[model samples]
Target: MAHTTERPVREREDASIGELLSAVTSDAQKLFRQEIELAKAEVREEATKAGKAAGMYGGAGFAGYMTALFASLAIVFALANVMDWGWAALIVTAVWAVAALVLYMMGRSRMREVSPKPERTVQTLKEDAEWARHPTR
Candidate 1:
């Protein structure tokens, strides 16, 4: 005869209702904790993206200020002398303007990528709510 580990149907059915409820409660608590952890991870990732976007904006602002400063100096020097130092200063100003534009574009792109809401967590929580409503499914 083969050895068997299965409990008899009568013995299985004898499990107390309190025991079953306790097991369900324990599992629910574990699931809740896991969901919380997932949400935190998602939020952290989004926050990091937002921080990068903000930094890019700061860099763009600095570049814009430099562009303005250089352009003013270029204009003053050009009025003083139209040929040598003036042209050089104007070239430098143009370079700063280009840098400022590039930085602004990069910051805009990064800002677009950032999302304040945690999308994945929202979707999962919605699913969890549905499951809570119809757990047997």
Candidate 2:
């Protein structure tokens, strides 16, 4: 026997106002849940970006510290042999200061790239509001 793929039509015309309202409510709830899920996903993605930015900052901090500690000591001692110890120390300090500034700027740049707002979620929420207002469209 061949089965027809055609499905029965919903007799919305015969449906009571209560049933129609119930359907609208159910649809609205489902739509809300979907929107929330979308928002959560978007937020999670943004948070990951933020986390990466934070990691960059942390790495920069650690690198800056290590550079100051080891490089400063070794370079200062090597320069001390070539020049007065005080001059060598001052020159090493200046170099390390510049290096630290560069690292800080890099970390700041990475932080600037991180956006806490979920842009897609906000846009979709606005669209959802518009659709809720005029669902016929």
Candidate 3:
């Protein structure tokens, strides 16, 4: 069976003002619902991307830590042949301390470059709310 997919395009032109207003209200409601659905889908898509990126960062961090541990072990063993084991351990500890200090300094510098607040997004949302309530102003 062929299903009819048509909207009533024939307007009475004589439609009462109340009828027109009712139709407008219905269409606006439908449009609002559709906008909400679209926003929800967009947020879901963005969240999925954020989750994947976070997982990738976590994996990279884990691999970096493992590499550092193994390399430290190898270095200590190699240095042990040239010096006492205690001295080799001390050298490795000193190197790690220096690396940690360097990382802390760089992290602090980068944090200074980042904004702590969502300034633009907050402003835009406030403007949208204002326009919605008082469209002309």
Top-TM-score structure, candidate number: 2
Candidate with better lDDT, 2 vs 3: 2
C-alpha TM-score for every candidate = 0.69, 0.84, 0.51
What shift in Å separates residue 104 of candidate 1 from its native position after superposition?
2.9
lDDT of 3 by residue, 1-137 (tens): 98843334255476677776677577658756765665566566656655655555555556456646876789899999999999997888677666655555554554454443444445555675687688679
Which is better, 1 or 2, measured by TM-score?
2
The per-prediction CA RMSD against the true structure, in angstroms, equals 5.7, 3.6, 6.4
Report the lDDT tens digits of candidate 2 across residue range 16-81.
777777777877798889888988888888788778777777877887789888998999999988
Instruction: List model 1 lDDT by residue over 3-30, tens digit each.
Output: 8544433565766777666666776798
Best by lDDT: 2
Clashing pairs in 3: none
Task: Estimate candidate 3's alpha-carbon lDDT, on a 0 to 1 scale.
Answer: 0.63
Model 1 poorest 10 in a row by lDDT: 4-13
